[model samples]
Target: MAHPRQADLAGLIDALQAEGVEFIVVGGASAVLHGALAMTQDLDVVHRLTPENVARLATVLEGLDAFVREPAQRRLRPQAAHLSSGGQLNLLTSLGPLDLLGRLHDGRGYDELLAHSEVLTDGIHQVRVVDLPTLIEIKTTAGRAKDRIVVPMLLALLRERERH
Candidate 1:
């Protein structure tokens, strides 16, 4: 029952990149960065699915003292295999909730997402954030109630970006 305080996204991004864990920032965080005017407590990243990358991610997770968020597996520690498995991992780290997605719907991985991403620099650290169009595609495909709720906002943001 250890509820660690949420770590700032900059710190998390710096840590992950410092560890050489290849990933792309996605979900609500990306939306907000792309001017969607949304809020997200958790950081969602689509990590690369290579053994070396997974190993790197595992190292970063270990350093963060990350554990599974699921009640049934809260005590279970994450492993490199989890990253290599190509799915989503809901984890709670000393920093905060971090969702590591190995792939998105229909098995789109880092390479695919990265192709449609933009590098965002926060003065200290730089990370690839999914572009607004692709993020909209992802949200539309996800089709969850939460994902659906943000589509219009994202579309509006996209239109605004296009106008400028």
Candidate 2:
């Protein structure tokens, strides 16, 4: 199925925050929020693994009309069971691509990363976003070509932020 040219990241963030889902925005979106010029097609979040949070996440997923991005024909809707499992779920929602991760590539989860995150408000919703240092650490550790290319830019952003 063809997706929207761009993901409605704010809408997705609003939905998750509205539902009281415990999550921390990470990856490219987080980098962008931190003033990086990186572009992301999906909103990646690391959610708390508690049963209640999982249920809430499942509800939000259902409300968003989310389904497994792969096997486009199947269109499998994610369940609480899926959310509880510690891994990643690449989903296509009405808002666009939403990747719910149980943990990061280096095995960091919501609880672990929470201390390194900050709650930012755009005079609207208050969302927790991973710090640039942590984001840089994760991306650099991943070492994928795409991730590698962004590290330098993120480093520059971090340096610029430090100068202020």
Candidate 3:
């Protein structure tokens, strides 16, 4: 199995946006976009579970040549059924690693998160990213060691954002 040597997070987001896939950037990627000094190996997103959105996401995934990044030997490709199953999928694609989540650990899905998200544009593409406070709440609630490590930094960034 060929591992993704470098993750092209921007490219991944571009691809998703191009296909009209409705998803909200979450986890470490959201923190980074919000100016937090955090490092992440994959682009984590919470996708809308509608049939139309799933179809678009599947198309993008196919274009990316995505495959399940587990049990190295099996090399499973995800289908629309899997995409709409309200589950998490960790995939390795030509562009990079991508984590497609149907819902957050705290049971917040795309609809729930959309209200707390904001759209950011870089001239060409507009990407939706979860806000700092929401991201911090997610990380804090996650209670993982890595999540905990980043909470303080995220909080500091939040404070800075508020001041400016």
The TM-scores of all predictions, comma-separated, are 0.91, 0.94, 0.94
Candidate structures ordered by lDDT, highest first: 3, 2, 1
TM accuracy, model 2:
0.94
In candidate 1, stretches whose alpha carbon ends up further than 4 angstroms from where it belongs are 5-7, 72-74
Q: Across residues 1-164, which tens digit of lDDT does each residue of candidate 1 receive?
A: 46454546777887899999899999988887776777788889999898889989999999888888887354688877787999999888878888899998778899888789999776765779998899999899989898899999999988887899
Best by lDDT: 3
For 63-99, candidate 3 gives per-residue lDDT tens digits of 8889998864687999998899888999999988999
Q: Each candidate's root-mean-square deviation in Å?
A: 1.9, 1.5, 1.4
lDDT of predicted model 1 = 0.85
Q: Roughly what TM-score does model 1 have, to 2 decimal places?
A: 0.91
**Which of the two, 1 or 2, has more TM-score?**
2
lDDT minimum window of 10 residues, candidate 1? 1-10
